[model samples]
Target: MNKKGQLIVVSGPSGVGKGTVLKEYLASRDQIAYSVSATTRSPRPGEEHGVHYFFLSREEFEQTVQSGGMLEYASYNNNYYGTPKKPVEEQRAKGNDVVLEIEVQGALQVKKACPDALLIFIAPPSFEELASRLTGRQTEDSKTVENRLNIARKELLCAKEYDYIIVNDTVELAVQRLAQVISANRYSIKNMKEFLDEVNKHA
Candidate 1:
């Protein structure tokens, strides 16, 4: 019997290094599929459509949401961002673990839609560190940074709702922890039934 892939939902506050950790984790694994998100925001330099994001028009995005094609969606800074459901299903059908890097709201929606999904929350070492990371980037103004910090605080509160939390004090250690979580889940009883049945056949 073939093992079905697991759906992992990764979420965290802005500037928590969730992307960096996930990048490193995926680099070390071959069977994992990263779910690319769809957004109405303009693509930045070096970002390719369907690679970094599926850049969509407002009408297109709304149509997808209305058609129930999005796993989850939310508006940020007047732009809509969402995860397309088809790619995730396709990857899972191929027995490749699917990882989704989304915000809290989308994560929750995924949890509701797929109860077996492993919800992991990435956190900064501290609020001061989170603020420093957000400001040190120099990409946003003070007001923007403050707004992100405020949102981060609220998102942090939802961390308890997740199945696991990884504090990204160091990228290397965080990547290790994330890998361990996935590895452990892969061998979980819920995921092992098919393998056990195969063993019973040999027995």
Candidate 2:
């Protein structure tokens, strides 16, 4: 069997620089397909559709769930976040890595659906630093910031379940490590044993 591309699952706290790391990682690589999520939340002032997210209506989101169109999905703060199964499967079929930037709940759901997927956790240097970064952004009000911090505290518990943890102290270093993970997963011997056996037969 041919070696298939990997499904990379990434989750982190709100202020852990996950977005920056992903941006730099994408900029440096050509074969990766960043999974665009289907979300019911309205885009922010400058956010674009199909880039930041695939913005959808509540009814459309429900139809996706009902039709088994999503690999995984979850509701948070009254908004729906989901990973569309089609694009990801298509990328994998074409031997291209598909990276999913998901929350812990959705990450677990993907793991259940695709046990071969690689799970990575991106984190800040420390909880205090994460909080500082969140506050400095000025994107949300005090209440919203507090809510995210609370969720971050809960999300920290998921670290143990992840396959690898990358600290986002610097975007360059984080992107480099993420690339390494993608490369290494492609060479996983568990999936290459059959090819080796065939080579031995030829020898």
Candidate 3:
């Protein structure tokens, strides 16, 4: 079957180990990419441009939005972030699975745009673990941490919308699960039925 490459949409709340899970998956796996999101926020100490995020200025980000360059855009805490569409399409065209590590809103939008894409949610084993992960980072203030916790609860509620919900107890395990999901999705009958049916026309 000549099927297009899969777009795996990974979504979860803050501090859910989603980033860690994806990073580990990337390190071990071949033929896939972790898409870089475009954001107005400044890069942190270790982040690289076009790797962690596009790190655009507010004007450039807004220009992309106005020009329809973004596949999906979301505003949180008054700043803007979006997924640039062209590069993702280009990657997928090369038969590589393009993983979009997006939040729930952008995930849903991708789901609508390409229903064939796989959607997975990475959740912590418990709320406490999630909270610890957030606070343990020591990146945000107490008030910001509190706000994230509040949002986390709400994001968890959308778990039912995804294809699979995998609790990330450890990075290795989560990456393994993600690999399994990708392997299984590649052979899903929905993506192969057309080819099978057409070839059996003489019968």
Candidate 4:
């Protein structure tokens, strides 16, 4: 029988390079599924439905949330974002670790729903550095950047709520740390039940 996979939920402030680190981590691993969230927001350039996110109309998104299709969800910037329940369960059943990159609100909700879920919070090396990164993006206006910074401050406060905190000083280092966490969990006694049972039968 296949060992059940882990459910990992990652939360971090915007522009902290969570995406860069996670992208590299996924590139270097196998049997790790990234949970694509559903959103009511319009897709950005180069973003595809079912790839970047499961884009849905506002009505459809609300209907799913009401009918229990979402595992966790929250509204941000006037748009709804959420993890779909079925895909995550399917990936876990197939012995593939599932990673959910979401906001703090959604992450907390997930923790309540799945007590075994590993919650990791990625943080910037410093608030100043975080500000620099946000402004450096140049994608959004200064006003938007400032808004993100304000939200980030609140998000950082919630870092203490996570099971682990990873300061993303560098993409390479962050990815390495993430790998270490997953490796440690893979060998944890709870995850090693199949091996333990086999040894018990032999004894």
Candidate 5:
């Protein structure tokens, strides 16, 4: 039998730099595919629909959620964000490991939906550093930034629930850790079951 791909869930607080780490890590991983999520939030300056995110309206996003098209979803900052079921399954079925860079809520939901999925949390070196990064971005207003910081505190409490937690002290180091985690998981007992079974039979 052909080897099946694994579902990787990379989650963290808002300003943890998970996206930057993932981007660098995935650059050298040809067999891994990044799962694009659908969101009700408006695109940032350089973001494009179907590229950065699906960029759906509230009604469209709710319709997908209601129809069970979303594998997992959560309301964050008054906007809906979710993983589309089809694309992820399709990529995994094709033997391409799929990674979902999502928030804590959606990551938990995915864990329930796909028990075999690998849950990795990215954490900031310190809460103060996280605050600095958020403020440095200048993307949102002061009120919004405070709201995110509040949410980040709560999200940090759930990091222990994840299978692995990597601190984003430096983007390069975080990328290295992420790659190592994925490589190790690929050969884990659970992920290698089919291959192991075949080997046992041959033996």
Candidate 6:
């Protein structure tokens, strides 16, 4: 029988380099599956439906949430974002670890829905560094950057709720730590039921 895959949820405040870390991690790990979230917001340039996000109408998104198709969801900037339950389950059924890169609220929701889910929080090396990174992006206006920093403060407070906390001082180091977490989980007692059963059978 194929070993069940793990549901690993990665979350962090904006500008903490979570995306860069996960991008490198996914590129290095072929066996891992990246969970694409569904959103009611319009796709940005170079983004594709079903690839970057499963873009849906507000009504469609709400209906899916109502029907329990979403494993976890949240409203941000007046748009809805959520993880679709089917794809995650499908990937796990094939023995592929599924990674969910989401916000803190959605991560908390996942924890409640799937108690075994591994939650990891990424954090910046320092508050000053985080502020610098947010400004460095130059993607958002100053006001927006300030807003994100405020939100980051709150998100940081929830770091204690995660199973692991990774400090994103460097992309390489963060990816290494994230990889170690996944590797360690593979050998966890909860994931080794089949192996234990086999050993008992021979004994």
Give the 10-residue window scoring lowest on summed lDDT in candidate 6.
Answer: 185-194
Candidate lDDT scores, in order, read 0.91, 0.88, 0.87, 0.92, 0.92, 0.91
- lDDT tens digits, residues 144-176, model 2? 899999989888998888989999988889989
- Candidate 2 pairs with clashing backbones: none
> Against the true structure, whose TM-score is highest?
5
Q: Assess every candidate by TM-score.
A: 0.92, 0.93, 0.93, 0.92, 0.96, 0.92
lDDT of 5 by residue, 38-57 (tens): 99998999999999999999
* lDDT (tens digit, per residue) of candidate 3 on 33-144: 7789998887878999988999998999999999999988887655787899998899888978899988888888888988788999999999999999999999989998
Estimate the TM-score for candidate 4.
0.92
lDDT (Cα, tens digit) per residue for candidate 6, span 1-203: 22888999999988899989999989967778999999998887889999999999999999999999999999875689899999999999888999999988999999998977899999999999999998997888998898888888989999999999999999999999999998897787767777888888999
Cα lDDT for residue 117, candidate 4: 88
- RMSD each, Å: 2.1, 1.8, 1.5, 2.0, 1.3, 1.8
Error of 4 at 107 (Å): 0.6
- Candidate 3 residue pairs in clash (backbone atoms < 3 Å): none
lDDT of 5: 0.92
Model 2: lDDT of residue 5: 72
Cα displacement (angstroms), candidate 2, residue 22, comes to 0.8
Can you tell me which runs of candidate 4 are displaced by over 4 Å?
Answer: 189-203
For model 5, the stretches where C-alpha displacement exceeds 4 angstroms are 201-203
Distance from true location, Cα of 170 in model 6, Å = 0.7
What digit string (tens of lDDT, one per residue) describes model 4 on residues 72-102? Answer: 9998767899999999999999989999999
Q: Model 3: which ten-residue window has the lowest total lDDT?
A: 72-81
